[model samples]
Target: MEAPHSIISIISSLLHIYILVLVIRVVLDLVAVFARSWRPTGPVLLLANLVYSLTDPPLRFLRRRIPALTLGSFGIDLSFLALWFGIVIVQYLLAILSGLL
Candidate 1:
């Protein structure tokens, strides 16, 4: 018989995928910052919009609750970092409970 996957394993896997998605969203936003003039066309724009829709909720929530990192005229949104940290901590705790780490 094949070994069955545990619920913790599935949850951990989903967490990992979500982490990647969140990171991609942040990286896309950062690149857009530098290349503001470039605009995506066709399906590219659709994909970008999809990512924006998925990632915006948590970012907006954190942005409202936490102050951003800033120096002089420039400011960096730390919500992405906060979200990533929070996800990793939960993943870590779950792994510990599952005895996978």
Candidate 2:
């Protein structure tokens, strides 16, 4: 039988990769927003669009249900941050549980 720790390690690693992808998507979106004058096209825009499509569905759904929190002129989108942190917390909990087992 496969050891529980090994299985948990595998799962955690997979989650870590997923988190990294999510972070990259967020960073790319921010960059695109700030660099709108540059006009990325062809493959670069295609890649960004693909990543946005993949990342936006869940965030849009959550955002519709949750109200945005405002701080003066800027409002924070907690839904995306919540999802990201939730994944991290889940990974940490899994690691801890796996260690205990």
Candidate number achieving the greatest TM-score relative to the actual structure: 1
Model 1 lDDT, full chain set? 0.82
- Could you tell me how far off, in angstroms, the CA of residue 21 lies in candidate 1 after the best superposition? 1.1
Q: Model 2 over residues 8-101: C-alpha lDDT tens digits? A: 9898998887777788787786876898876658997887777677778888988998889999999988888877887889998997898678
What lDDT tens digits, residue by residue, belong to model 1 across residues 11-99? 88988988877877767777788999878789878878887887789889999999988999999888888988999999988878776
Q: How far is candidate 1 from the true structure (C-alpha RMSD, Å)?
A: 3.1
lDDT of 2 at 52: 77
Model 2, residue pairs in steric clash: none
The per-residue C-alpha lDDT of model 2 at residue 7 equals: 87
lDDT of 1 at 72: 92
